[model samples]
Target: MADQLIDSEIIQRITKKKKQLDSIRPLSKSALQKLKERFAVEWTYNSNAIEGNTLTLNETRLVIERGLTVKGKSLREHFEATNHKTAIECLEGLARIKEPLTEENVKKMHAIILRSINDTEAGIYRNVRVRILGAVFTPPDPVKISRLISELFKWLNSAKMHPVELAALAHYKLVRIHPFSDGNGRVSRLLMNLILMRCGFPPAVVLNTDRKKYYDRLKKADRGNESPFADLMAQAVERSLDLYLEALEPVKPGEEKELIPLRDAAKGMPYSPDYLSLLARQGKLGAIKISRNWVISKDDLKKYVEKKKSKS
Candidate 1:
């Protein structure tokens, strides 16, 4: 049964391969192009959603480009508003978790995620009791939730576990506790990405595109089967890393003389060509002028892109 829950060897292999690949994989041009495109779309969508705008893809793009603020719509008007809140909460939750997780941090994340919702205690753990999938999962009685969470953080601090594996475990444990009445799924995933970002990895956005697979994997993990969940998470991580690498093409050995084209530099960027040119003029970028064309370094463009992202 334990073997069925988690494949120890597979876990080991994933950890080993992740480390090895991190060291050897060089950024490829094609991958970088695809990554930039995806990131442009994702950032537009996510930032709008975070700011309480429930927008479709087209609307999101327009909003990002035109600087339009969503107005007159209640928070509930957004598509899957509750879920969006959950996702946003997840991202914000991660940003605030200090290294070496703590009882305070867990509660802090829970509180932030559940702020406006009416859940028994709102942000507090259930004092009564509850069950999940017919299994009675209870929070620590009264004050014990804090203590148990503290201990969990302590274990996380001391364990020699790979950060990714630790992320997976944290997700499982968080859901098992069912700390909040709602938003546990979002919180768990947010917690997962929090660990990932802290470990120098990019954020993994789990789109609603694979809702069925997502829930099914979670159910399987609940039944003492972890591989399905682990595999799903691994794929998500790989996708995120692939996109990130594609966005930021690492400088290769002896390639400094090969100038990056302006069109290519702005390939995945969300800003306009005119805006990019202005940025270059401000000494914010290293650009090359051609016959009626301008090119900037991928690195320089990335900084401008990030600056826009920060403002959004």
Candidate 2:
């Protein structure tokens, strides 16, 4: 359980591969714009899924514009409700963590994820031992789950790892522990983004498109070869960062006059602060900035807004 045993070779390989990939795959401004559009659609789709309504990209866009929720009466129904609640809870958890990771914060995050779940010890560390990939990966026994988790948190603190890297590691570790009986995948992904968001990065999306690659890499990591998973995660992080930078590209001054600050625009709107912050951080804040404080021109804001609207 020593940090050295975690294996740094994978980490080194990932670092090298990331550099090579960055050299060959420079993200253009246009590609970033496309990513932003895709992200907005994806966010809505995922959010809708949390609400029990499986949505296509177009449907997700519509749901975002016109609020809709699925009405079901089964586990799926409960999942939808809990999923939406869990998403919001996850965002809130991100807001609570500060600077280096802390044991208290990790426990709080676990609690947020299991808030309404029916687990025997909802929000608490696992008491019974668990296995992964059919192997007795052996987490600390139930009696030791809490202390072990705390130790893990301490290790995370000592690593002083970058938020993106920490998020990736946390995801792998949390899944490996399988602390909860259900909702582990969703919770782990949420925890990953919580760490990323705390580090000022946009949330990383694990697309169904790359699900196989994701699983394969995770399996490799579980077998004590962390490089493949680390590299895969790094690619996801790079993709997210590229899209983020693209969204933030400055607009031509004086292009659009009617653009208002998102908070001001959302004064009576139902959008959450987390959502608004994402917009601002990603450079989609034209609609959120006050008109008087508009840094970019009216025409530019108009153009950007129109482009975004058109895609929606």
Candidate 3:
């Protein structure tokens, strides 16, 4: 359904990077373990925070890794942190076995997300109409939810498109369905990453920092355009690829495509730092934002210039 909505450039980059990651075959064991641990923690923290969980990243680490309840936080918030970690473990299991995601998996993911928080309504769909507070669209009537979900799974079964596109659309479809009253957003993101992992891609994290952009993209999708959201997902996927490759596949000395601050990266380049930063923010350039600063690899800078040159 979303074969054409994603930016071709981003898709091509993912394709290239996926091939690169694949060529390395098995990643170093220790590095892979450490990376997975870090992602599991970051993923849990960001996903829960987006849902209003008050635990900071370090506190989330303590809760999940150290099994300590954070002070000044509610029991439900603690459960959210731990529950999300368990749900991610499930996704990792599914990814390892290469299991096809079923309708049951969807419910199970939601259930795990809502465990200890709302036991009764954990996996069950709402029986009444509901509206997202800031969303531009209303979820389908509760009666239609089952049928809508049925259709969604049918698409999941037979859809033929880029995995990244398919994953992004799946997330959008679930969020639009709003299958469960409370944990719909969390489940949608989990499902998205599950699809990616099953397809041999790293789990793409939708950072809590980008929650507003995330929702804005969804709202735009509601307005008959899926590109913005799909693009957002593609960028997330690319970021993870960079993360994994940096940790697992080091380049030969003096040839590393190391990421540098945009200002330093632009010192001798044709594009000014501000101009390149604009492009990066717009998703036209491959870059990663660290805290408040944006960084781009020299290779990505050259790639951007080559593409623009050809277009011009």
> What TM-score fits each model?
0.56, 0.57, 0.95
Residue-pair clashes per prediction, in order, are 2, 20, 0
The local distance difference test score of model 3 is 0.88
lDDT per residue as tens, model 3, 109-218: 98898898899998888887889989869899898988999899999978999999999999999999998888898999999999999889988888888889998999
Model 3: residues with Cα > 4 Å off, grouped in runs: 1-3, 309-312
* RMSD in Å for all candidates: 14.3, 14.5, 1.6
Segments in model 1 whose C-alpha atoms lie over 4 Å from true places = 1-74, 77-98, 117-122, 131-144, 250-312
User: What lDDT is reached at residue 258 by model 2?
Assistant: 41
Candidate 1 per-residue C-alpha lDDT over 269-312 given as tens digits, one digit per residue, 9 for 90 to 100 = 77667777775533344343422355544644565567678989
Query: To one decimal, what is the Cα RMSD in angstroms of model 2 from the true structure?
Result: 14.5
Candidate 2 shows a clash count of 20
Worst 10 residues of 3 by lDDT: 288-297
lDDT of 1: 0.55
Q: Distance from true position, residue 213, model 2, in Å?
A: 1.3
